[model samples]
Target: MSEIPANTRPLEGPAPRLKAPAGATDCHIHLYLPGYEAQPGGPKIPELATVEDYRKLQQWLSLERVVVTQPNAYQRDNRALLAALEQLGPDTARGVAAVTPDTPDRDLQAWHDRGIRGARIMNLPGGAVTHADMLAVEKRIRPLGWHLMVQFNGCQLNDYIDNLQRLESEYIIDHIGKFMPPVPADDARVDDILRLLDRGNAWFKICAGYEASLTSAPEYADVGAIARRVIAHAPERIIWGTNWPHVGVSRDNYPSDADQLDVLLDWATPEQQQKILVDNPARLYGF
Candidate 1:
């Protein structure tokens, strides 16, 4: 393939034969096709990938199951994502989808049966979900027992935290609340974010090596500290993901997947690691 010397590539390997609790899951990964149902007047994703690509990645990474998510490439037609879900087989995969404001109940039900468990709200990517649209979207999905997954910088989340929670639904925070250090939990600025977590309807994923550690260090203890605190509060609510393909990502100055796993295993006990690396995602995604 084309070599850019800068694209973040996934590491290939098998699980070190350390007995992970049965049924572990990889909570995040992306797949793409050249055109994800592109349409006139619709926004097209600049980056794209495919399912055939994902199969190779799964084998290389030794992940038992995957939570396939929409990567903003599909505009709003999730056909490509849903097709990938259909082919992944129920026992090995599940997904979160990007749905339109007017998606119907019957269609959502069909997706649920096919193993899609959540929806993604990408705040960082300039898309807007208005207050009315938020309620409508929640209304459509409420009966499915799925949460609204949000991916945004912690700063932006802090701005709209209250309104986000008002959707009257559970929510997932991507990448350790994107925690920025030096902001005390006591500050009023974060009170809205605090209330969401306190209500027991919020969860977070510990991914993003670069985002957590600004310097691209593989031994990202400081970055993991943010995750550890969240786990301490509610281990069951915390989850983990590989962010595979690392697409458009830069390699760490010193790179190693074993190093990343080492930090994760060191951060949590064997059982907790299973929950983080395995059990929780199964329950949440129905994998």
Candidate 2:
């Protein structure tokens, strides 16, 4: 009954119907603490969602681990993300950072020591890094055992699959590869995604169905089909997330964290759910 925190959105509802396994991880979230202004070209969202706010969400989801992604709004600045990780504790939280080509290796090393396991390429609009920076970042973070996490228009994934395969470090494609307009279940792009997984070079984060869904909220049947395809192909390689704060997405369409977790029950079996929600992230993020 205490006053709700300022500058943050509330959880959609109560805890989910599906009980999460112990050590489950929400692998893709962002932190926007107060006073951290967005850079000139970064993605914009109103207000800030702090680590403290997200912990309430974790408790609601019955999740113990998290991966706080560096949002495009912060561009190459990782100070806010690092602070969130510090608060979440190294054992229960990991992070994916956004860094520019000019960022020093020492800085990257420092981020690694702080529990960042991946370097993110926000390939969408307002992103600071680009495709050109992928190989360079791979070269830099490979020594530290970090992979490259990428978010972009899913239509273009095939164009970069070969490039992604060649990188020495492992990689991840965000949001079911986030195919815009929601490609057909049999679309060649889906095949390409399967191929990328088969090649054993990359992983997929099954988050943000609304980002690519042509259908309405709660079900997102179109994107759900894509998620099933990816999970059917390799449950061991798939991870789940809330895409918390749901930036750029309208509130009316934004799903509750519980609803987001419930959708998985419709996609994968209980065992597969454990792998996606708990086991896979354990291997990928070292939880």
lDDT of 2 by residue, 126-222 (tens): 8778888888878888888998888888888767777777887778888888889788778998898888888786899889887788897778899
Off by over 4 Å in 1: 1-20, 34-48, 126-132, 180-195, 250-261
Distance from true location, Cα of 14 in model 1, Å: 8.1
Report every candidate's CA lDDT. 0.65, 0.84
Q: What is the clash tally of candidate 2?
A: 0
Question: What is the TM-score of each predicted model, taking all chains together?
Answer: 0.80, 0.95
Could you tell me which 10 consecutive residues in candidate 2 have the lowest summed lDDT?
A: 1-10
Query: Where is model 1 poorest over a 10-residue stretch in terms of lDDT?
Result: 1-10
lDDT, candidate 1, 1-287, per-residue tens: 22223222444555543344556566777666543444433344334555666676556545678888766545566777788888788889888887656787788999888887888776654343433355567767888898777776675565667667677777778766665542343445445554567777777786665554653355566556555666765678777776655554544443444454455665677767888877777677766
